[model samples]
Target: MTQQELQQLVEQISLEYFKRPFRHRVVINHRFKTTGGRYHLADHHLEFNPAFLTAELRTDLIGIVKHELTHYHLHLLHRGYRHQDRDFKVLLQQVGGSRFALDVGNRRPQAKKFHYICTNCGQQYHRVKRIDTRRYRCGVCSGILKITTKM
Candidate 1:
């Protein structure tokens, strides 16, 4: 959705659920990586990940909005706005906000450690976790495997 639509949605949700007006800007921040949304304490602006607007991630979008709104409203009211606070937890539950942002697993394979290269055949291997190069060898040519990169 556009920034204007997101702002309207946040205003609507704020009034509907919290019974308070959201007098702050809501922007779609495409650069947001892991977290679904973030409420800026200094400026009181709410930022949402653009991925949340997609059809497959609508529920996550709502949940994240609620989560950020929880912080927004609480901080505005000078109440406990932190995740560890009771007020934050209670309000989040009442609003059906996600306790933690949903982990939509990394779209691309993350760089792995312990890259192994075959000595004889020049084969390459990547592993998510560390592997013992000494115990493993190249299947193609039974070549000794060497560590290429740590990550």
Candidate 2:
């Protein structure tokens, strides 16, 4: 949907769900990579991921809109608007907003792990960051450590 259509939908949802009129702008942010939407506390504007704008993901779009709107309304009303707040939780459930942002492959890519083994003792050690095999030795046997593999 176009940005204008999304704005109308957001305004409509605000009125229907929270009984409040949304006066701020809604933006379809193509730059959004990890989040379904974002609610700007400074401007009271809402930004949504453009990836969820398809017909197949309309429900997800609505849920994201509602989730941001929940933050919008609660913050404007000076109620607890944070995720950890009781008021935010209650209002979000009352409005049927999604509790979490829609996942958009936000999982962090795992860093390569370094696997090491002792030459004499066979004790293994796994670490995320690379370690110096020359300086570090096996903890159990104090034997020379060598690179086993990487994952």
| Model 2 C-alpha lDDT per residue in residues 35-103, reported as the tens digit of each score | 899999999999999888989889888888888998898899899999999998998888888887667
lDDT of 1 by residue, 1-151 (tens): 7889889989998999999999989888877778788999999999888877877888888888999999999998999999999999999999999988777763566767668889888999988888777887888998899888886
Top TM-score hit: 2
The Cα local distance difference test for each model comes to 0.87, 0.88
* Deviation (Å) of 26 in candidate 1: 0.7
Displacement of the residue 76 alpha carbon in candidate 2, Å: 0.7
Q: lDDT score of model 1?
A: 0.87
Task: Estimate the lDDT of model 2.
Answer: 0.88
